[model samples]
Target: MNWKNIEGLDGVESPGLLVDSDKIQQNIDRMIEIVGGAEHVDRLFPHVKTHKMPEVTRMQVDAGITKFKAATLSEAQMAAGAGASEVLIAHQLVGPKLDRLATLIEDFPNTKFAVLTDDPQAADAINEKCGDADSPLDVYIDIDCGMHRTGIPLGARSDALRAHIDSLSGLNFAGLHVYDGHLHDPDLQQRTDKVKEILGKVALHEKEHPSPRIIVGGSPTFGIWAAETSWHLSPGTTLLWDFGYGDAHPDLPMTIAAALISRVISKPGEGKICIDLGHKSIAAEMPLEKRFQFPDLPDAQPIGQSEEHLVLQTANAASLHVGDIVIAIPRHICPTVALHSHATVVSGGRVTGDRWQVTARDR
Candidate 1:
C-alpha cells in the first residue's frame, strides 16, 4: 500500500485529505486555455462551493479570474477577502441573512457583491436591508430553466421580478442567472442538445428584455455554454475534479487533484479488511461502489461502511496489513472536502508542510 515516490508520506496521518498544487494549477490553466486564454478569464465565474478555501480562491485570482460565485456568505467573504474583483452569492438570501449580505458589502467597499433572487419578497428584503448603504446592491433574477429549483419561472414571472428590482431603491438588476445542473448526460451530444433547448429560452428572453449580462452553466454544461461566448460561464468542479464527473466526461482536460489517504486498521475476517475512511471521510451521496474507488486495489469491493470504518472484501486482502496506507479518489469531491477541516498540500511530488484550512465549511 505504499506510494513509491511520494516524499513526506510517512509523516501524514491516516484518513487525511491530500491536494496536489500542481494539478490545481493545471486545472486552472486548462479552464483558461479552453476559454481562449488569460484574456477570456473574465468569461469564467467559477463557484467557490467546491473548494471553499481562500488559498484556492487566491490561485484563481492569480490566474486572472477576478469574478467568483459562492453559495454562502462565508464563501463570498472569503472570495472578496482573497482579492477577487467581484463576488456573487448565488443563493437567495432572506430574513437576517440579508443583513449579513449587506454587512459583507459594507466590509469590503472596493469589491462588488451581488446576490441571486427568485422571490419578489426576497428582493424586497434585500432592498430593505441595504437601504442606507452607500450604493445599491447588485442583483440577478434567477431563472428556472427546467431545473425547477429556486428560480422565478422563465416567462412573465421572471419579467415581473426583474422590473421589481429595477424599481427598488437599494437594488440594481444586473442580469439573469441560470444553472443547468440537471443536464448531466454521459453522452456529449445529449448534453449539447439539452443546453441548446434550455439556452434557447434564455436567448428569447434576452431578445425582449435586453439584459446587461447573463451567467449560465455549472460544471456539467461548462463546455456547452462555452460555445456561446456571449454569456458568462460559472463552472466550479472543473478545478478539483472527482470520479463521477471525470468518468462521465472523459473528453474534459482536467485531472483528479484531490484524494483521501487512509490506512488499513484491522483485518476482522478471512477476506475482509477495514479501512479508516467511511461516510465521515468521503462523500456518501452516491452508492458505496460509486462513492470512491481504490486504484491500488481495483478488484476490491466495498462490503460494509459505517460512520468511521469501511470494510472491503478483495482477493488481495492478504497483501495488506494494519497501518498500510491507501489512496481513495472520491466520486464527488465537493462534499468530501467539506467533511475535513484542512488539506495536506503536495507539490513537486512531496508534501509541502502546509495545510489549507477549509474556510467556508458548515458556514
Candidate 2:
C-alpha cells in the first residue's frame, strides 16, 4: 500500500518497520541510569542478537558501551566492524565456524573477541583454529544457571572445564558467563531472589577457582543484577522492549523503540479487518495476546493470521478504513527485527534520513 500521503513518511510504504532513534538513545540512557551512572556504562555487554543492525551497535559504542554479546559469528564480526572494542560470541561455535572466529580475531586486531564454550571438544576446536592462526582468543566458561540450555553445570565439573580452558594454548580463560534467562517472574523481588540463588552457586565456584570476571543476567533480570551485584550485565531486549518483557516486568524504565507499521488491506466480515501484518511481520513465538499489541486499536483481537494477512476482530473495525495505518509492538523484538531487511528511522515524530539495514540476519 502507498504511504506517500502519510505525513513525514515521504518514501515509506506499508508493512514497514519503524525505529525511533530518540527512543533508542533514551533506552541506552535508561540502562546507564539503572546501573547508577555513566561510570558503570562499561559494565554493560548488551547482546547484539536483539538488534543486529550495525547502526544500533555504533549507537551503543558512542554511548560508551564497549563490550557486546553476539549469538552468531556474523553478529560478532558486525559488532567488531562497528567499532565495538570487545565482543563475546555467547554461543558455541564448532567446525568451520571456529575457523571463522579465528579469522575475525586476525582481521580485527584492535577489537577483543571471545566465544562461549561448555564442551572441551569445542574449546579444543577453538584452540586449534586460533593456534593455526597464531592469534589467541579470550574464552568465557558458559555456566548453566538452571537454564539447562547450553552450559556446564555449576559445580566441580564446571571448575574442571575452566581449568581445562586455562591450560589451552590459544585460549585465555577470561571469566564466567552465567545467563539466567529462565527467571522471568513479574515481581521484582522474586526475580531478584532467583538471581541471587543462582549466582550464589557462581560465588561458590569462585571460592575454589576464582574467576577473573563474571558476566551475568539477560533482559528479564537486568535490573536485579545491575542493582544487586557488580558483574558485567548482558541485557539485550532492554534496548528495544517487546510486549512479552514489558508486560512481565513493568518496573523497567524502557519504551518501545521499534514498531511494525501495517495498513488495513481488506474488510472481510462484519467485525473483521485484515491488516498487511502477518506472522512474518511480527514474532509468533508467544501466544496471541502476548505476541503483539496494537496501540491504535487497543480492543482489536487477532482472530487469524496467515502468511501475508492478520485478521483482527474488534468493534472499532468499522472506524478503520482501507489503507489506514496501524502501529504494533512485537512481543519479541529480536526475531521480529530479523524478518525485515531494513528499518525506517524515525526521529522527532517524523521519518528522518534513510532506513537502517538489518546487517546480520542470516547467521
Taking every candidate in turn, the Cα RMSD to the unseen true structure, in Å, is 1.5, 2.5
Which residues of candidate 2, in runs, are more than 4 Å off? 1-6, 132-135
lDDT tens per residue, model 2, 192-219: 8898898787777778878888999999
C-alpha TM-scores of all predictions? 0.97, 0.95
lDDT (CA) for every model shown?
0.88, 0.86
Q: How accurate locally is residue 5 in candidate 2, as Cα lDDT from 0 to 100?
A: 31
Name the TM-score of candidate 2: 0.95
- Give the top-scoring candidate (lDDT): 1
In the range 177-227, model 1's lDDT, one tens digit per residue, is 998888889999999999998878888877888898899999888987897
Worst 10 residues of 2 by lDDT: 1-10
What value does the lDDT take at residue 252 in candidate 2? 93
